[model samples]
Target chain A: MQTLDQERTSAPPKQIEDLSLLGEVSHRTAGVSRLEMCIQCGCCGGSCPSEADMDHTPRMLFAMLRAGMRHAALMSNTPWICVSCYHCVVRCPQNVHIADVMYTLKSMAIEAKLYQDSTAPDFSQTFVDMVEEFGRSFELGLATRHYLKHFPLRLPNMAPMGIGMLSKQRMNITPTRIKGIAQLKAVLKRAKEVEAAS
Target chain B: MNKYILYPGCSMESSARAYYDSLKAITDIIGLNLQEIEDWNCCGATEYLGIKLTPAYALISRNLALAAQQADGTRTVVAPCSACYLNLAKADYYMQEQPVLGQHVNEALAAGGLSYKPGSLDIRHLLDVLVYDVGLDTIKSKVVRPLTGLRVAPYLGCMVPRPDYEHRWSDYEYPVELDRLLNALGADVIEFPLKTECCGGHMTQISPDTAFELIRRLVSAADEHQADLMATLCPMCQMNLDAYQSETNKFFHTSYRMPVIFFTQLMGLAFGLEAKDLGFGLELVSARNALAKIGIEHPAEIPTGTARPKKDGSLPMPAPLPRRNMHTEKGKVVK
Candidate 1:
């Protein structure tokens, strides 16, 4: 059994620049390799509840990639609909790390400004902003903001619903910020240093 | 006393006040000192990152920087909110994973005169402290009233265990920490399969249908399992499952009145603390009936009709199984 440090040392470096035109934003080693480990066994697609709705299932995505259908595989909505349940990761016989790959691919697709969806990007951005602003996700604030961003027209209609939610104390209006923002900043810096070295 | 820096995030004051209150009460009893990080900010929950990557992480990193400054040699920062714990842990993990991303975030932090060294602090969920720091044995020793015959479904939600930076948890699908804790308290813990499923996160706002479908699965699963109540470590999970059960029911044209409580509340109950002290009355789905099943009655009376038979027909009887010694060293179970 290899120690965690040994595993890290033997693991391939995450090469961001090698993953298409998105350049540094796309992690090649982390994304495609995660997809490559899939034996096209369909375990992930089989277990995925959302696989039916997806244009290309996770298994098909991996199989297509292995067959050199890069454009077709990259263009599909297979990665976007993933709920990140980690069911695929847990059930994977080959330790394919599908969810992580999906995340990396999604990041790449977003950076490349491809596969633009009205709701997904807005949702992802809203999530990122919540973390950035307060060091925590304020669900009430996030839900309200996400709706406004994705469905601006729906805001007026949502107001009554929002009020109803607030009345029931289901939606909290105030946002909570984490303490010691400085230490968090340092950790980010150190992470940058490590990333730069890698 | 183990002094830890506490990051309450925003929900603790309002939506998750019960979790905040119960955590404070439980920690006080365990002789643990929790110091709140002064003037922390919101951890972009699940939205900010969806909008923009660099700025979103930078925003969360700022909080970690402040936490490090106030560390006082206690490297562990405990977050009661699942989103806070996930965001903080993700920022820390990714900063080490991607350098350019970390540099940009650090530059953003420098403007605030605060910086953090990656891995400077061990960001842990409050559940971790209770099970690991306080130890199940210690908690068991303090239980004035074992939660005799109370059936609980341990709901972890998503976030905390996944993208797990420190590997402080067990199997992602079925982490037994909370289950083990409840069992130690003598509660009849249910083996809930959807324990780690997503609670729709901010999607409850973006698309209620989508959110409702996800929430329905969890509630129905718990209901299917015939769990008396659900216990959660994440405020969002608790908030979504507890606060949205009615709306979700309306949307799905189904009825479910499952009470969701913070795990700390159950801990308080096992310790013989009054339900009110644990903020049991604050839940949208009243825990009164669930408590009544265990002979633990609450002041707010739940309608008698809501009480149903345990799914397994084993109500008021502990599941017949060999009892393992509850007090084991941390990380031993994982190996």
Candidate 2:
């Protein structure tokens, strides 16, 4: 896995126009239009709480999308780093849904198999797995699997908090399945089929 | 009694048990009748929607579909978790606004022999329903302990107020509903300038340094204002600010233990509910010092401003930038 530094220094992939990322995304979802409306304003970046940690600021990512650098934008840590705080979306002068655009990039990234940096993506998948398994989340299980996978070293530091929570009866060790888990799974399976059909 | 459906997103069961417990306790006092949506799944949170749209929306909308089935003329569905509430409301609003998306989502719902018409259910955040539906004055009437001595900085985080399709929040940038609600509890509500600021959300898990910067901004700002504690409405915000505070402090070489508790938890406390029942000790940063204020006679007034002159001559926070009115010409935003 390339470190964030490597990811940042990595060149924008030879400006390939095999597909216009922005155009493809807009075509897929009509909910977005203001992509063409971005004034290249720095509102999204400036308002982003985690922009400094991102490989590309939201503004730069948008510019890359407009420039059709799909590979570069998709591989960047920008989309993965977004916490969906939505500060930028509401603050955008042009009313561009910056958060939604990040969502689009994440979907595109997953579809194209471009997310080589795996910590955040893995965390997301772990979360989904927990939910999918029981219909409700299992935090202790999710945290153990996640930290032991991506961040074993930090586990010791996090143990005290975990212990505190456990002592307080805050951490439920058992995974509780929703009564309609079968129905939820069916809906999810069908949703995937619908997505694939589209 | 105000009746509505409650979708206690997964976190309410495990990580935010305090929130779930306190919300349950407060509702009884406020006369809110919440019908739990039978067998609701996760709301897909902030993670799933980014990974896949249809399935994620379906996962969230399935809950909506189920709520619609059980609405029985009470169409409102309230979620206490900000992310769950946002996802549910977004699914409902976007499905109504876009036909193709709605059709695709409903197609998925059909497999489970369930279907939800767009706008069939009223999706709302718990804070919205409490402040708007319950009314502050009515809440004020029930506050047995009046929280007079405890000074709280009302932190709304980012989700509850923004992209409000229902036009419920008073203002997107600087919503005063939380402040008003806390005031109705008779707590001294500090005029927190960063009330609507991002609480770094899941960045605490993904990038610790980035999350610390955001957390520090909120915690230190509250500390600077001499707030006894910081109260928020979102489970995500409480976890980030309260649980990760010391980690943030360790990273930034600063020491701050600004107690971040859920607003509903505070509400339960003011309604004369037991602190243990409100899940007070679950917070990594203890609110005991702040809560202990309840024991002493209530202070009539506590001054809020620069606690003392900054010896190093640090300037006060800059005036907030004026919002750009969207109706103006393209070039109207001055650099």
Candidate 3:
């Protein structure tokens, strides 16, 4: 509920105080080559749909990693803005797992408390929490909680569409849970344990 | 009847219930038997994979383990949501490509007495199975009313084609399977250049400006080509391009009411199914105008020259360029 809480007093933005995000991401993506292979060919940046909004191009971010400018790279909004489109990964000359690299960067940034854009992270945490609780995402619940928490002004604007969906029976208020949620929970717990232990 | 397991991801149950309803309505007609997995969990989507690696993989693998447990003889698992399909396929592909990842995932699986072999089951998107396995001939035979007047932009979004891992796609950047499928149904299919483009998945909920820019590009392109509606295979794409379309237009100060709909819903519509059963009115940007072109409510009338394309036949698909690493102007794919 920490992430799901609606009344978040906006925290003051801060520059990244650490410089280990690059090494941490590299460790997460070991064995099958890593981000170090990026040729800085600009393929990822070229194919990016949201590149205009990103503070650093993906290629530039890779350059930052190589140059050991961890603070600047982590502070950039590139990782958060990535839509996971995978346009760069499949198009890369060196076969860099660009999208996966972004995922790693994002997770590391959140762990280091570097990311200031809370909306994307909040949405992710809310989605994970929904899955953790019911084994499935409840749409009305997720959307309601998300908008009410982050953008209350947007809800009234969305009412007509919400009513339209409801009238068509597309909006279900109750989240249907699988019968074996206990077993699912056990698996998730063990997985978390295994991840932590590693 | 063809039998396979179905993994209707979480979206198909709630936000994409229209997809679920329409898919169920057509499977019987298409001669498919989709047996549900006994019990499954969420795929964690793109989010969980970002937050935590092992737990995310484990969360997704639980479903595969359960599906393997419930296989009974069939090994193919079909997921309707693109995100779910990609996540499921990634678990299988990556677990094999990197063995240590597999070892970690299985260790987590061992806790609940569930385990999955990387190559045990073939995870497929519903569109792939429908297009390849079901074939286009059977689909054409079943279309009671051809979508003669309605022009459609077949949008496959980003995930399904690229990073195919299994070599299942015809081309990475511009796969013509959806366009061909829509063409065979007699709709006036356009040469939509952005068919395989990104829909800024989950970005609408994150950054409205970035998402709207992406949405505006696709919507405006479809509108520019004078397409009556844009048909899609992924629910996330459909929701972003359809439900949030109004918001996107307002943000951009544009007024394009292009309707984005699921391909299966369009298939259901062409199969002579009722509009209500096909989940027509669920989209925020209503398809009434597009449907009216086909005379859904009124008497079947021939569309005027303005509504028709330059030619009566479907637009020819771009020539398949040999795969190369170099980037170009057209949809030439690197993979």
Candidate 4:
């Protein structure tokens, strides 16, 4: 396993076919991802609201997965671009769980440290950190930290709306911690253990 | 009164407080006995599910476990937020569908001295409960001040209807549940093609350009259809279209003032509840002009200078569909 820094700086690895890629993604998904059942029908791509922003459409990414192009599959920005709207999941002729499959691919990419963009992963991490800490999401804190780190220039533009939210009391200045934070944290910790064991 | 467990998500406490407030007022009028699950944590939203599967499912199921424990005589758990509803429903559905996943999640729950049987609880959205359980006839009977001429674009967003594990929707592409409910309240429901379309979700936080274009599409479509305002079921949809409308305008160099609000707020209005009680002025884009059509003006709403467009020169919009006389059969609403 290459370090994340090395993986980013080094030249692309030779395309050695990893035949388990499709099944691996399927296994990681909570329910049957049905990734192997994809017919490349383009329904997923056609129905995707964010297809224009993705490097490869979901259909193309599935084709890559079938070809065992693990490096390419993990590096593509398609999964991160998916908003999990499930438009493709309902539209797919084969009943493929396209959105859940995207989640599996995202974790895999994060595990391999092969994704091209860090914006989505970092955002997800920031959100999860707040959830772990307070047992609930802190929108004000999350937005502040996220904008300051990623889009410092856009902070001024975001101020008017922030002030409106604050003045109207739509968002709280301090995060509200849940009553069962200790219990919730224990469950999360044990969940990680179970995942590792599996 | 029909009773159930209410899983008001984290947003209900913060950004979506209007939804929470309106829900409280309307539930009293509609006779929905909603008992909140005690000490429930967040459902992990769409974020944790992307990072790790087991932990994410476990985190969401923690709420399910709590709701299950607190399920006195009611097996039903209702969530008002679309993302929260989807996550909770997905966890229950997937746990039953894949027993191995359920077993692993239960292992995590053991640490917290909790275990939830996958199929023991029924997860439903608050809209589903309002329409199906409470019945449209009941909702109509309570309308003291009908929203007669208010043209509303009933936006359900994506999460509420799609991948509907329980087959609870009218149609995935264009669900008429919200349309019919609004019509019952006397709003002129518009022909909104992007009703089930994505409202950019978390893209506003991760990628503003991508999110802005999506928001622009929904808002522009609602405007083209000549909707006075867009009424939505999800707080995220309300926030994105309401809070981010100006930013989207700046990005696209277009001025579109479409006030996005929660459906419950509108329902509260139709039921003769005070605007303050229904969280009328909290929206970033003021709904004053829209409500003014029905002779209901919010005190805190600042007046906008933009004149309403004359309907003559623009190509005629397709007439809004006739109101459906709906009846539920085996948990599915049919016209």
Best candidate (score: TM-score): 4
Best by DockQ: 4
lDDT of 2 by residue, B1-335 (tens): 99999999888887788899899888878989999998889887788877788898888888988899888879899999888888888888888877788898899999999998998888888988998898898899998988897899999888899877788899988999889999998899999999988888877677665677789899999999999999988888988888788777766668997988889988987888888778777777777788877773221221212234466777678876774432243333321
Please tell me the TM-score of chain B in candidate 3 relative to the true structure's chain B.
0.88
Candidate 2 local lDDT, residue A101:
77
lDDT string, candidate 3, B16-67, tens digits? 8778889999999989999988777788888998888888888999999999
True contacts reproduced, candidate 2: 0.64
Candidates in descending TM-score order: 4, 2, 3, 1
Q: Show where candidate 4 strays beyond 4 Å.
A: A1-17, B301-335
Worst 10 residues of 1 chain B by lDDT: B326-335
Q: Considering lDDT, where higher is better, how would the candidates rank from best to worst?
A: 4, 3, 2, 1
Preferred candidate (TM-score higher): 3 or 4? 4
Candidate 3 clashing pairs?
A: none
lDDT of 4 by residue, B86-119 (tens): 9999999999999999999999999999999998
What local lDDT does model 2 show for residue A49? 72
| TM-score computed on alpha carbons, candidate 3 | 0.87
For all candidates, state DockQ relative to the true structure: 0.20, 0.33, 0.33, 0.46
- DockQ for candidate 3, please give it: 0.33
Residue-level lDDT tens digits of model 1 in B273-306: 8887887777878888888888887866322223
Assign candidate 4 its CAPRI class: acceptable
The model with the greater DockQ, 1 or 4, is: 4
DockQ of 2: 0.33
Best by lDDT: 4
